[model samples]
Target: MDPEALNPVIDKAVESGIPVVMFDADAPNSKAYAFLGTNNYYAGVTAADKMAELLNEAGGEVGVVTHPNQLNHKERTEGFRETIEKEYPKMTVVDVKDGRGDQMISKEVSEELMREYPNIKGIFASEANGGVGVGKAVIDQQKKGGDIHIISFDTDKGTLDMINDGIISATMAQGTWKMGYWSLQFLFHLQHDIAGELEGETNLPRYVDTGITVVTKDNVNEYYPGE
Candidate 1:
């Protein structure tokens, strides 16, 4: 999220009497009206907690697999690193690898990480492809069945299967349904329902957290689409 690059475009929209609201990812410095999607930082914090639990809270070395170019991934990595550093002082994020949001790239990078950080006890995948790739690396390195715990993001069916098969410890499921549903609601309100300023504040909310859910083997069936 380059504020310098995005703010001018958004500011132009606002100046033209057009409103812009961000979803999923954001450049808060931009002149966007609101952001309605997952609270990515909080989601990262939760992922760290889950990773700690999977590691039995022993606090060992872990790594992160992500797309370095994406802002949301950066935020997640930041939150995960901060939580581990502050709350679990014994654990260290040994390294962070860029997957470039590609399955093959994520797998290759994760494999390299495993070789470099041989003692890594946990891995956090900050996106769908990163999770899939890291899961494959764990299996290929003969470290399956929770040997090197993995906490991934997204509720993809393949990811859910990995959770059941014990390749991934769990996954963070975003409230995409809520995001899609409420996007229309928020837009509708912005189009016609928003009243004028009240006590120097607008009627619209600045941010709406659609929320997240941790999907594990126990609840994989509930999240996965059935045949």
Candidate 2:
């Protein structure tokens, strides 16, 4: 199951001995056997480094927003925060809002942040929905889109448009297809001994590093919808 978005639901299933495999995000505490997803922390770290490279001199205030209390969001934010603080102390993270994966709510939160932090020069979003939501908010304000330098996650429809239109800066594309594919594969292997599992390999790889790539205006066509 795609536990990245909903940990508790998957955790519950895992506790009940249901063959659950995670994706995109993880559930370490849950008894789930295996996880098939990206190293979200590293993804966050890479995003921060890219932002620093893109806006080294234009640093003012950066913000990160995500769905309220999501596991993947939490990990992404943690990585982003840790990397930014450790490497680019000049850039500061000002406000963090919970968009709840809702467009209206994300819009409202982004608008409020803009009003509150006029110096917000850049933004990093932890998920596809939050990225598009913040992008829409910035566009509605008629602000200089390129100047904000947004870095987002996933490849949703709105996010793709924002990247293409230069409303957002870049996005980290995750192996979502792998998330689905491996989750099922691992579950099947666990159920059947066709492969004859090795001894001493009791637990699954505590963490699986799926993979990620940065999508930007320069190479946006490489990730056009349906491509």
Candidate 3:
């Protein structure tokens, strides 16, 4: 269903007495019981920070590629653009391409981007597949990876490999496993009649900060997934 089309279904679920929590992205208008995922907007800002740290000096066009038309990607791009414009005014965002979440399409799109914007100084990917796709493009083109900073999302195996080999400069980490675990845990509690809201002013993390981390070549080894 289209994002606009999801609100009704979400409302129906909520009406039927189901506690809903959206992962990866939130449905602001829907009656979602809670949001358990990364602070995507901040994640984009984090990406910009990583890019600035990697480049050390700003004043180049930043290109973003992701699954086009996705609400999450759209928010990320907006956040990244807003931060870059406010903080690194010299760094112009030249273009954004749609990867369609397909590796082959991502490669093709990345190749096209390379040709269109040869001076692209930085690249930001908002999803795992897109990041790996862009990584493959950089490797295939034989560009000096370090010369052009690349920031990606997630810690998938392919992304980790790229970080290790120095193809991707950094990646934004997300707690995929924790999201599933907590979502179910919350649902279980709701079903068990446990109070959903906080008891008092003692404070409650209204949203679970599943957390995020920046993975780079310098610290990539530290983030190797558990065997």
The local distance difference test score of each candidate is 0.85, 0.77, 0.79
lDDT of 3 by residue, 55-147 (tens): 675588778888658877887788788888899877888888998877778878887888888887788988889889888888867755425
- Over the stretch 1-227, how does candidate 2's per-residue lDDT look in tens digits? 23444667777886675667666656676667777788877888878888898886455678888864766777788888888888887888887888887767777888888788877777888888888888888887765433467888888778888998988889999988788887777788766744244574434565667798998988777676677
Provide backbone clash counts, one per model.
0, 0, 0
Provide the TM-score for each candidate, comma-separated.
0.91, 0.84, 0.87
lDDT of 3: 0.79
TM-score of 1: 0.91
Question: TM-score of the candidate numbered 2?
Answer: 0.84
Better of 1 and 3 by lDDT: 1
Question: RMSD to native for every prediction?
Answer: 2.2, 3.4, 3.2
Candidate 2, superposed: residue stretches over 4 Å from native: 1-18, 143-146, 195-204
> Which pairs clash (backbone N, Cα, C closer than 3 Å) in model 3?
none
Q: What lDDT score is found at residue 158 in candidate 3?
A: 91
Candidate that would win on lDDT: 1
